[model samples]
Target: MSTAYGLTAVSLVVAATVLIGMFGLRISRTTSDFYVASRTVSPLRNASAIGGEYLSAASFLGIAGLILAYGADMLWLPVGWTGGYLVLLVLVSAPLRRSGAYTLPDFAEARLESMTVRRVTSVLAVLIGWLYLMPQLQSAGLVLRTAAGTPVWVGTVLVAVVVTINVLSGGMRSITMVQAFQYWLKLTALAVPVLFLLIAWRQDAAPGLGGDAPPTFPERTTVSIGTDVTVRVPAPVTVEVRGRVDGAGRAGPLTLTAGEHTVARDTVVTFPAGAAVPHVADLPVRTDAEWLRPLAGREYPMYATYSLILATFLGTMGLPHVLVRFYTNPDGRAARRTTVLVLGLLGAFYLLPALYGALGRIYAPELLMTGRTDAVVLTLPGRLIGGTLGDLLGALVTAGAVAAFLSTSSGLAVSVAGVIAQDLMHGGVRSFRVATLLALLVPLGLALSVRALAVADVVGLAFALAASTFCPLLVLGIWWRRLTVAGALAGLIVGGGLAGTAVAWTIIGGPPGGLAGALLAQPAAWTVPAAFAVMIGVSLITPRSVPAGVARTMVRLHTPETLAVDRGTWHPKGA
Candidate 1:
């Protein structure tokens, strides 16, 4: 792909975002406007904006990458992601909107009537938001490197700066329009490339995917190893090497044995057509049939699948994008309706990424060797449909990739910055600007420092963290009047501690194998249930600690504004 086209595409996306944000700036004169767009967004528009905000790097690039590496079971990434929205629509949308809060911390304080609960919620939301933002930045870096050969840090810093500017410019109001537009662009970018890609695939006689043989290079291919990687080949293959391999600095034809071998950074190897693809040391080795089969080539597949389900199905409720929908909607009804519409929008958008993933297996098997499977989406268009058309499609996809991260990152920056400004600092635009910088910078640094985990896996971990920490709090605080301040705090601590530790373990290198590793790698199946149990048990044991006026609060949460009650008469005291 041409660097000019990629850079130009990215430039246009940034310019459009800035211009749209400036339009929003004109009307964002009040705190409410900046935070929630004064709750005037219509269902359709709000749904589109949420689509932009919700479909992050995970949806655009990471899902396809994981699908390529993990096979059919990885379809759960999209299934779980969309099903998670269904969970949000069914369980969270209306009440969360009816609560009339800008952030999760705000809702916690109002519903539980406890400063301690509020502060804990704020801290967790910030932590989770920052955790979630790292992958978005990491993905930005990956796409940028693939597109332009720029340093990885360049993409990371670029996304951080763009998101901070958008968030600081008009806050929620500005980002609403910017993100809504991006959602459509992202859809087009992915959708258009697939048409050409499929055409090209068929022209090559449409190779069957059900064969038991391991995927081999469909044609002679030269792959540049961007970094040092230990690859495990399934069969012996001779390759022309241009750099160091296995600690030898030779430049000639070499044969890699059918086992683990190291390729140093900047090494370029040319494989003969039909040579079997090698995989990174960590990736599962599987034949085509095994790779395509559901639950194949997995460790503890049942537990991992169920844990992923719980994380995504329950975890999405705790994400910032969900809150953005409610805060920007006119009422609970609109929020609920917008969720239903988003179900369609998100569903349509998700279908395209899977195609990219499946086709990648046939066309770009080299990615497994480098463990840069996340580059599958951007890598496919150019390889499948070569020459000028491929380059243009690649550039369009590059722009869409930028939109993916920028839109979601903007939402997260706003969500975290809102908490920092409203809860930690003064209540002004200046505070919001400063908070935006701080909220994004921390995650930017993390993305720069850590580069081991797959972007999708890291994102899944974030989901587990959110599911464990906040899902119980929201479910109980909104629906169960018996929930007490002590219980909420206890639940947050237990859930956050357990999940946070699991996340840290996975990131810093956990146990090498067995059930213990699987449990920590995907902790939601246990942690989420434990969190609910602890919160309920503690709430029952400390009934007297329940907030006063619990009945009224419950009524307010469940009742609609259409009822003959004053909406503004009761605000959380001292909040």
Candidate 2:
């Protein structure tokens, strides 16, 4: 694809988002508008906005790439992600909306009647938002580097600057429309190019996926290693080399053994047609048959699969960015309706990425060798379809990729800013603007400083962190009237402590092989249950610490907003 097209596509998305936000700024003139769009969004628009922000890089780019490399087992990711909304609709949406809380901290304090619980909740909410934001920035960097030849930091900084401007302009009110618009743009951008791609595949005699064999390069391909990486080669193959390999410089054909080999940064290795692809050290290598089988290629597959499923299924209600969007609905009923519509919207958008992943195996297997499978979606448009037409489609895909990053980052920024401004600054538009800047800055630095992890892997860990903390608090606090202040606090500390520990350990030092690796990589199955058990056990032992207003809080949470009652809407303490 032309560099001009990539730059133009990115510029258009930025311009469109800003223009839409400016339109929202015209009508947003009060504190309520800044916080929750004055609680008047229709269900369709609300659901669209939710889909816009929710379908981060994980949904748009990562899923397809994971499927390309890991195959059938990876399908569970989308299943768990979409099914999470079902969990939210059934257990959380109506009650959370009826609570009339502007943020998680507000809900925690009102339900438990303790500023202590509120403060803990505020800290956890901010942490979750930042965890989620880092991946958006990282994915943006990866996309821009692919689309244009710019350094990764350029895309990372660009997204942060744009998100900060939009949130500071009109807060949630402005971003709602901005998110809603991006969702359709993303959908169109992805959905349209796929049709032509499928047509091209059919015209090429429908190449087989190398039945029961490891992925192979379809044609001669040259792969440039971006960083030092060890790849596991399944078989020996003669390849032309032009850079450092195994601490020696080479410029001619060499046969690599069928085992681990190290390729240094900036090395260029050329593979001939029919060469077995060598994958990164960490990724699972599978034959087509094994790839089609469940739990066949990965380590401790059963434990890893179940743990991931548990995190995504139970974690949706815990995500601060996702939960805060409910407050934009007009009433509890609207919240429920919006969630129902979100289920459908998310279901529709998720089906497109799998196609990209599946076709990638046949058309773009070189990505597997380079360990940049995430670029499969962008590469497919140019590889299968060529010339000016292909570049145009590629540009459209680039635009959609940018939308994925910006839409999701904007939501996270708004949620984090809302918490900071409400809980710490005592609530005001100016405070919110300052908070927005802070929210974007922390994640921007993290994105720039930390080495990039797989986009989906980082997001899954964020869900685990959320599952361990807010999942227990929200579920127990809303339904179980006996939840006490002390219990909530203990659970927050224990749950957040364990899940956070697992995430940090997994990121910093690679886990040991066997069960220990799987456990650290996906801890929700154990950590989530441990969190709930601690919250319940502690609450039972400390029954005396239950809030005196528990009964009234229950009524407010469970009651329909249509009912005639004082429905004490929650705000930050002393606000």
Candidate 3:
């Protein structure tokens, strides 16, 4: 693939995003436009905007990589992610819009009638936003480094700058347009390439895509490892190498019967045509048969699968970015309608990543050895179909990848910055500019400092945290009339503390294998239930502490806007 094409594609995406932001700036003259698009967006546009911002690096790049590496078990990821919105639509969407809060903290304060709860919600919103933002930045680095052959930091900084500028221009109103445009751009980008790829696959007529054997190199191939990787090879073979291997510098052919071999950073290893690709130390190696069967290929597969399902299904409602988008709708019915359309849009977009993953397993198996599976989506175009057409397809994918990062990062920056400006600084455009800087910087630092994990896996942690903290609060505050301020605060503390600790442990200190590791890595299954239980128990105990306006608030949340009764649709100050 030509680096020029990738760079051009990325450049165009950035330019388009900024231009869209400027267009939004033309209409964004007031605070309401900055925060919630003046709550005038129709269902279809809001849904498209939501879909744009919602499909992050995890959907664009990570799902295919995980599916390529893990096969059937990883399919649950997309299923859960899509189904989570179903959970959201049925439970939170309309009532949340009815609540008339511009932000999650606003919702918290309205429901609990406590500034303390509002502050807690504000902090949790920031935490979730930053946690989600880190992986978006990291994935941007990966995409740019692959597409344009640039330094990883260059991509991260580029996304940060573009997102900050866009957010500062018009805030949510601007981003809504940018995001809605990107959603279609991304869908077309992925969908068109796959058509070409499928044609190429048919012309080649390659077999063994789902064979019983492990993946093998079809021809002599040289794989350059950008990062150090420990690979477990099944058999010994002589291989030509350049750079460090197992801490020893080697520049010539070497023979090794491998159990595990360390290929140092920047090493180029050449494998013979028929050599079986080795598995990365972090991922499980499996036969084709096992890979085709769910729960058969992974350690503690059942537990991990269920945990993943729980995390994504319950987690969607808690995301600060997602919740912020709901406020863009004009009314409760529009919110519900937006969610239904989102389900369709998201469902359609998700189908393509699985296709990419399946094709990747057949054509790009060497990624397993290099632990660069995430690059499979970018590399497949060139590998499957070479020449100018291949380069064009690759560039399209690159553009989509860039759009993914820009749309998601922009939304997160806006959400986090909104919370910070509203809660900490003055509620105005100037404070928002300051907040955007603060929001982007901390996550960029974290993205650089942390070891790169699978993008989807890291995102799952954010979901888990969201599921633990806000899922309970939203569910209880809206549905349970007896919920008290004490209950919401206690639940947020306990759930956020546990989930946050688990996140730290997984990131800073890798967890050990077995049930404990599975539990820690995917904490939502236990943590979400624990949060709900704590909130409910505490609410029951302190029933007398329920807000005096509970009846009116319930009526406001449940009543139709058409009814002349107040539905809490007042304009929010710092929302």
Candidate 4:
């Protein structure tokens, strides 16, 4: 990989992003323009922007890594991610746009008619936004470190600063253009490289994927461990080491037994051609046959798969960054149309990552050992076809990776900042600017402090929290008509508290394996239903707590925009 090329690509992306923000700055004279692009974004453009912001590091990098390491079962990640939008389209998109709320808190206040509910929703929105943003920041560091050999913090700080600048410059107005461009840019970057990679594969006789044997190095390979790692080797093999391994400092070939061995930080191990790749201890071990089959590939596979589906399927609607984009649409109909188009765009883009992952298994199997499976997309071109062309392709991928981080982080920052400004500050431009700083800073600090979880797993945690809390509130508030303020607040507290505890534990020190660990790791399956039940039960118990405006709110949420009915409209503070 060429650092010069990687750095150049990253620089161009940052400059272009800032330039787009400047363009938005010219048109953003009003608060509405800054907040929701004056609610005038067209369906196609808005859909493109949604695809851009929704496809984060998890989609671009993490999904490929998971596929390469975990095998067939990991396909559910892309499926669930894209299908979550379907759930959103059918359930919440149009009605949410019709609510005429500037932010989630505004929606809560309007629908529930309770300031307390608004405050609680504001806190959850900020929390979910931050949880979502943290992974984009961490994955930015991973991409930069792999592409340019930069320090981890360099990428984290760089993305944080760039996103803050973009958000503060024009907020949603500027980000819409930048993100829309980014979607195409990312699609081209991945799509073009994969075509070349496929050509390369065909030139080499198109190796078959079904094999009973585990992935093995095609040639003698040297793997450098960026961080200390414990790996599970299936069989004993002699390997040359340059650094600490198994509590011994060795520079000569040594035999490793068939078990777990710890490789110290910065260690380099050379394996003979055809040596089996060892997986990181953090990942569950599976035979090649098991890896090829769904449900058999992972521990407690059925439960884990179902939990992932539950989280992503119900979670998309609650994501603060995603929901804010719907508010940019001119009307409820445009919002629905935008969601329909987003489904197509996202579906098309997702096909490429899975291809990269499967190819990675054949071409760059050593990544499994290094536990840097997340680098599969970035490293594949360089490994499979080395030369200036490989470097160029790798740089294009690097630029796309940077775009993923920048666009998603910028959107999340804007959503978080908007909530903070509207609810916590004076709801002015200056307050938004300050809020932008806070929004980026908290997650940046967290990204630096916490050990890196798999990028997709971190995102899954955010989805679980969102699913458990906001999914219930949004669904019941819009449809049930009997949802009470007390119910919404209680649901938010109970669901958020439960899911947040699981997320914190997963981050700090994940729980030990068992039924408890399985449940904690993927909390949505249990937590989401619990949230709905609690909300419904509390609402039934406290019937008087229902908002007096429930009927009006329902009419406003459900009425077609084509009809000339007067659905109540609430303007922002200054509007």
Candidate 5:
């Protein structure tokens, strides 16, 4: 049960990543190298880097934990997270690169021709970047605390220092090599242990890995909403159960007829294992709702589904850290190819977490009692494969976990540095260094103060915010000639304000239940549409606010590659 191997593996991965980053530092000389690897990254290399940066703590750890805690209902977390990249591949990748902008704000200013819009977008970009970075830092803390017995803050500080050094020293150009290498490192770290664990499981005769206790009774272990307790029974059974009703206030015995049964509160029924349970024939049936139901009696409204879907789909396009990766590519074609490759890499990485979640259900059901199901993936590996092999497997998982935190934090710092350098420091070298430090500060502070936030929940808030504020800006700015500064500002203010307010509530107030809970948990449903509507509505009102070169910009954004490449006239706005 000692975690020495886990600690050693994590330390080794971190050291290796830093060493690779230092190698990039040796070759990177120009400002362009620091910012975008001088825009010369190949498709495969950039794709691996994207995969490395994209697989944050949430994807690496939180998804499996969510599934272990919530049952099949939580599969959407991984599905939505991975599917977001597909949206990126189809809708945003090529056009975004062809825009000749280094960052989201740059694209906004060039397309809208408005300094105000640019500044507003910059602020939102930083906010989104910081929000996303917080989880990575917090997860680092979790990994160290769980695996190495280190204090929670130790991991956060370690990651922040390492990532800051890499970003400040060599920027994207250097981090690119580090992330690309880390991607393969992470894959190996995960894949090797899993293969060994499966072999061990088979060799061990696949014992009943789960707890010896029988499953909980359906009638006694019912889901309670307010005063109502609902149980799903498929057959007839006799059991002893106690039910209570508000205002009725009395314990009673209930006998059920075979077909369907509804028991009032303060009623008790007892049935032994293997008894035939009566089916609830009259209750309205919902197959999808059943799949979506929370394990611990939690309920999310139907609208929440739309909110989550919108957040996942639109959020990827607007993410500042994700957007920055496109700039690392040499041209539009490379960007498109990178996005496609990202889909494959992400899809493969997601499969492991789902397997881990399933394994946790069978091997470590007690995780539910601990209320930290997120640790299930990390913990279950040790249980299934014991002794030296299990220890090694735990170590490998730890390395992947560390890689997740490092890759994401580095990308976020780069994005934050880019925005600060361009806007505040007038694109000067001194400004980039200052921005990098400042970028690390905001997330570090947040991570230290808010150590208890669930990784997936915090990440979801980031996605919702990104969808509301940045998604519309990127989509409309790239594709629409009619998009104006006024429209973009209106959309950002309305969309960003709503999403930001929701995040604030999530941080300060915490989720309660029902519709309010759904809104706070997933704000993208209303916020995204509200953003798009505001942009379109305001654009209609002040048509003249549209920039004069809108048509030309759209032509440049959408023109065939040969035409634009032949002109040799396309230069990044800032460059």
Candidate 6:
């Protein structure tokens, strides 16, 4: 039965994508159409495409899972993710579009008037693009394996082939139509199940615990501290226990010693359930938790906050898939309008995932044991609804999950392919064809060899890379007239090197904790400012190195839309 449902959904999605691609193919005539839809996309349609492509596997699956594991604190992930668009809309959208570039590298070259900067930007774009694509492929493999008991790689290969064909055949134009359709398809896929599950939950009287008895604690619970010490509690307790120490760095079991005892490492204390529990809210503002609230935990420190901010803000602007959609607009004003529409569409879609997370906290707490809370959103349908309705809902979620993977992977592949063709092969039919194959193959190979990282973690790494590299280049090159080639290179080396190292550590060593962990997890706060500083300082020291056409470029970037032409001369207008 599961196989049947899976096959049916897959067939329908493929058929729809092919049909859409064929529609695009009939109208797509020139290289310009394939690359940027001849820069004619309307604001509304472009916005839908942006929303579709932007909500990758991480947004669809990872956010709910993180919320399930971390409670309300995880809400920041989605909030940060969506807030990124707001920052992009305000700071970079119009000016970036007005630059009249096909990709990030194009803008880097045009603005900086340096082939060196263009090459550097292109390399970073491919890196970020591939890094982002890893999670999407992994998610595809996971969905097929979980839903249909198929070999994991089946889904990955299927998607790679389909996306490659779509991109190779029609490029950005084909994907825009496909992604716009997918956005609605995904929303329906999720919304339908949610509505049905809500109905089922209500019809079943919305019982607390879903007819299961409350969990009972064991007669005795053991509390372990540091490396070795353990204490046995006679009953369940909510108490703060302090420890004491002796010399030689060896501590005995936790006990109240004579006069004054200090809390020691490896000490364990236990209390009964009736004991006083620490009330975090009532604590003084100077309490450790209060002091550390800005950081997610002691293990992460300031890195967590900075990482979130960087991922949310800089990451949005750096994303190649997201940026390419702007190229589809008729002009800078249309791009700005498209971004505004995306903000509304994304804001609406985000609300549902939060709802799912809240529902999972109640209906599927057991997900913690599996350590795969990412599946909570998928499993909730069956648990909340029952029998056939539950199965149907589950299938719908499976479809959405598949769509998330396909749409995101497709977009990233398109960006990577475009960059490769333009920078490496000099942008033509042959370059596009070869680049398409390389784009799909490289990421697919990486996805196959590596164990699947958490979706958000992988996506965050992509963001960190973008923040370290492109974010600085874009922001500074657009706003700062003093930006020099030397400075951009220096910043790219320092910021990009640091961010890239952190990503490597994350992938190989797993999530770093403590200060190093904080740095690895969220290098953005430091890296972003550092990149900007380096760019400015270096440019200041070498004023003569500034691009010769700086004034003209600046004029184009800030001029109003009324002065801009549809074909060649582009200019930004007042917000």
lDDT tens digits by residue: candidate 1, 193-250: 9999999988999987888888889899999998899999788999999999999996
lDDT of 5 by residue, 1-575 (tens): 46678778877987887787877878877667777787788888998998888788888888887765555656777778778888887778888888878888888877877789989999999998999999889888888877887777899899999899878767678898888887887777667767876676678676442433323322232221211233444444444446642224333443343443444533444554433332222122223234234442235635665677789888988888888889877677778888888888877877788677766655554444334556766786787777887887888888888998899899989988889888867676677888899999989999989636668878889999999989888888877778888999999999999999989888777766667877877889889999999998998898999997787777767776677343324454446
The 0-to-1 C-alpha lDDT of every candidate, in the order given, reads 0.87, 0.88, 0.89, 0.90, 0.75, 0.72
Backbone clashes per model, in order?
Answer: 0, 0, 0, 0, 20, 3
Residue range 511-571, candidate 2, lDDT tens digits: 6788888899899999999999999999999999999988888889898867888656555
Model 1, residue 515: C-alpha shift (Å): 1.4
Per-prediction TM-score, please?
A: 0.98, 0.97, 0.98, 0.98, 0.84, 0.82
- What ranges in model 5 sit over 4 Å off? 200-298, 564-574
Model 5 worst lDDT window (10 residues): 218-227
What would you estimate as the lDDT of candidate 2? 0.88
lDDT of 3 by residue, 252-333 (tens): 9998677998889889999999898988899887777778888974678888888889899999999999999998888899
What's the TM for model 5?
A: 0.84
Cα error, residue 470 of model 5, in Å, equals 1.0
Scored by lDDT, the top model is: 4
lDDT of 1 at 486: 87
Better of 1 and 5 by TM-score: 1
* Model 6 segments more than 4 A misplaced: 200-298, 564-575
Worst 10 residues of 6 by lDDT: 277-286
> TM-score of the candidate numbered 6?
0.82
